[model samples]
Target: MSERTRIPPLSPFEEQAGFTRALRAGNRIVVSGNVGVEEDGSVSPDAGKQADRCFALIREYVEQLGGRMDDVVRVRMFVTDIADADAVTAAFSRALGHVRPTGTLVAIAALYHPSWKVEIEAEAIVGDE
Candidate 1:
């Protein structure tokens, strides 16, 4: 069996909800949906900034589970408004343009939090390069 590892979440709700921030099984890593909220519970009002934070957190978790951004093969982004798509795309480009992973962006009605404009998730394969 492939060894499995769980990367602890930065959010308290994750522990209470019985989910991890990320999981690694052998060479593959999957990061859960991440919001733009900070460690202190502060969130940016700007959609771009929030998306940026989500990507940052995703990168961090991927690395923690022994993967690089370049190994990320797929990403899914959920935005509360279609108008924010441009800003979120800009942020995604800034974060993963070099990796150029396959991605999907869809406008959703809302997130768990009212202030969250975007949520992101990632999947990566270690040493895929």
Candidate 2:
């Protein structure tokens, strides 16, 4: 049987719901929904800015767990407005560059915070164990 492992909990906020921020099994890492809250826990306004912040948080989690952005294989972006799709994609492209992981953009009614415009989740493969 394949053994399963869970990544260390990483949350900028003290009040978190019932969900791990990330999990690792062997060589693969799966990151949960990440928002655009700043280090001080302040969210950004613009979609592009929020997207950037989300990716930054995701990157931090990956690096903390001994993984790199290059290892990312999939990404999911959730936005409050469909009109912000281009901005979100542009921000993602800038962050991921040519890695070009498989991605999906979704429109949602709302998120945890009213100021938050975007949230991101990701999955990465480190290597075969």
Error of 2 at 9 (Å): 3.2
Error of 2 at 49 (Å): 0.8
Where does candidate 1 stray beyond 4 Å? none
Evaluate residue 4 in candidate 2 and report its C-alpha lDDT on the 0 to 100 scale: 55
CA lDDT for candidate 1: 0.92
lDDT of 2 by residue, 1-129 (tens): 445565655554523665778877778888988888888877667889889988988888888777899999999999999999999999999989688899999999999878888889999999633
Candidate-wise lDDT, in order: 0.92, 0.85
- Give residue 86's error in model 2 in angstroms: 1.1
lDDT measured at residue 13 in model 2 versus the true structure, 0 to 100: 52
Error of 1 at 83 (Å): 0.1
What is the lDDT for 73 in model 1?
91
Off by over 4 Å in 2: 1-7, 10-16
Please write out the lDDT profile of model 1 over residues 39-105, one tens digit for every residue.
7889999999999999999989988887889999999999999999999999999999998999999
